[model samples]
Target: MSNFDYDLFVIGGGSGGVRAGRLAAELGAKVAIAEEYRVGGTCVIRGCVPKKLLVYGSRYSSAFADARNFGWTSDSLRFDWPTLIGNVRREVDRLNGVYTRTLEKAGVRIILDRAVLDDPHTVRLANGDAPISAKTILVATGGHPMIPKLPGSEHLISSNECFQLEELPASIAIVGAGYIGMEFASIFAGLGVQVTVIHRGDQVLRNFDADLRDGLAEAMRKRGIDIRINTETAGIEKVDGGYRVHFKRGDSLHAGLVMAATGRLPNTMGLGLDEAGVDLGWNGHVVVDEFSRSSVGNIYAVGDVTDRVNLTPVAIHEATAFAETVFNDQATPVDHMMIPTAVFSDPEIGTVGLSEESAREMGHVVDIYKIVFRPLRYTLAGRDEKMLMKLVVDMASDKVLGCHILGPDAAEIVQMAAIALKMGATKVQFDMTMALHPSAAEELVTLRHKWEAPTPMAGSDAAA
Candidate 1:
């Protein structure tokens, strides 16, 4: 028998930590999981789940507009912020209860307090409980949105605060152009608010493929968002009504609200990682091996705290692998490659595998197949919106390298494509597949011509 009180002690009741703890207990190991906040963690509490609900709420305005084209005489429509906010909060609370019950049912001790490392094998609870001893400890404290320090920065809010706003502002000035900033911009604009986006880069979504970055920016602008690229906020000042955001170019933007979605940093501070001698990255993310093992053999970490893949599903995957490796005696390593992802912005974005730039940078001559066309749904609605789909292939091997889509249901479409890509599907194989009739996805298998390079957009960084 082990000399410790528990076989596994998990810090942070986020997706990864909870999964590992529950799995270990089900596998006949003593487990205890601690969380200072709600059990559902960031994804359910403030990130993907709540955010997607808001996205769904925001889309109804467009749905109402399109309904007229379908001979529906619906009128007298309105949106109530309080109703949506209250509903989202209730859903979150329900999920929290579900997560807590799941742990209890699995026979994992649920400690509703913060757990910090006392040493390699010991953790101390904030509630003044006796120090918990375990044969293995896992850190999955996740991350928090980062707001940069500037003059009058106290007036700025992060994405975490966006959900709790007492009332939706008439106008909101977002202070970054990354996924969070762009997504919130789209959400607010869709709900009939004036939105302005400020970014230091030339375009938004900087890390995505160039086509997606440019296409999304154009589409957002067309939808009435004021996008100020190649710009940075110098400071903020409280005015009579709201806040005045001063820019580096000696200009100022006044809005009822200011939100900063600049980035996220691992929540590793004050966790006693330094005294425990676990290695961390420069950004304070716990450094772990492919198997999620830390420098100290018995101490491991997963999820955002490790900074490998910040997606919630990826964290769960790592946690499953860790449990199998440690408790089940089956060595497993989490694979992080070719994961499918989505951005729930206006129009949406879905992508998987290497981007064209990265594929070319790796010395592969690429064949690009791309199309921009209106979806069938827009034909009767008379909406001028267009969807973009592109495939990047390695010319020499005909291996599909990337699939990117920016349109309605892009996430659902790319999810299936990810399966084929993961299975090493090639250009010839995509062509050989039978097309489903009258579907946007059928376009994937029907395209034949290799795209000829078009003249680059003026002042654009995208390659031909």
Candidate 2:
């Protein structure tokens, strides 16, 4: 065939690269995947896997409190950070081994070294291995947390550092109110740490359904979390006790640790993408076509490195499509629409499709169905927090355009909703379906009334 050492050379052994490598090798392609760190990439390492384990561990604190209302009594309660984190790390190690075994079983050559593009189809490994050539190259480097540039910013740590802390701090100040920051805020707060979340925006979870965004914040506040909105950070400085997060306007806040969870940038740097003629977007994202093909004929990219969706499942989805398209000769493009997503915050959030704001912006005359009530589980536990369930439907077609939820098991519930939305299920179909008794998700089918939007103020702009 082609004059190359391998059929595929995948850089960055994250989810996408691993999936592509395995699938391609399964199809009898000579595939090699390179990951500088451990395999399983961010999700299995410091991202979702470890973070979700921490979420599960953090919830025990609330569960213990709630158990008192359920007639369970315990005079002494203690949490060991070392035990939790150590167990989590062990699980991560297990997953890494699982992923490695998967690649090996699929006949993919795994390279434990950093790989850079020498040309469009040639790669150079950092461990002084001979340069390898392949017919096709893939970039799936993923991303890293973006720490803000300000004076004394060096004092700040990120989500990755959260897992590496030797001991849990007495208090933590998380900068940014995105999903990552809010999730950690929930974690630390649950673990009995005094936690403060600071964001420059006036609201938390920007771009989510407005009801869920505001409702979650209020519930978090009631749980004793200090959420500082419209509060800009000037810098971080070392203080006598710990660190002070200086505000751009008023009052500096002190904490044992300061974390910057503003956002993440694509890990497209220092990999010689430019030298290989691959285009990068504003945030070092590998610019690729719908087929994930780069400007260089045989070069392609996916996952957070391409910045499309940025979810681990999405990356795996894209990688699967890549393998099917390239090796199996099936021309499949990724479908980004109606993807369900979740935030592991205090009450949790799960949403699929468009928000009401997004639907309206797209010129959909939407009828919003929204309900807020304390969950049945919360009543017995004496938890005051409420659940928000909302649906955005196109008035013209009666088609359900969005589903948003904030409550326990929201993510689980939305997974079912995502299937409905993907199949273009209508409001009438949702209505006709019998709701399961005594479940929060049945609210999706039970909602009958349309929520009325508040009329615009006399001087304020709504038409504008």
Per-residue lDDT tens digits for candidate 1, residues 278-394, read 999999999999899999999999999999879998999999999999999999999898899999999899999888888988899999988777777887888888788889999
In order of appearance, the predictions have TM-scores of 0.97, 0.97
Candidate number achieving the greatest lDDT relative to the actual structure: 2
> Model 2 off-target regions past 4 Å?
453-464
Error of 2 at 307 (Å): 0.8
What are the lDDT figures for the candidates, one per model?
0.90, 0.91
What's the lDDT for residue 434 in model 1?
Answer: 92
Candidate 2 residue lDDT tens string, 1-464? 77999999999888899999999999989999999999999999999999999999999988988898899999888899999999999999999999999999999999999999888888999999899999999999999999899999999999999889879999999999998999999999988899999999989999998888899999899988999999999999998989988999968999999999999999987898899888889888989899899888799898999998989999999999999999999998999899999999989999999999999999999999877777777677988777888999999999999999999999999999999999999999999999887778888897788988742221111111
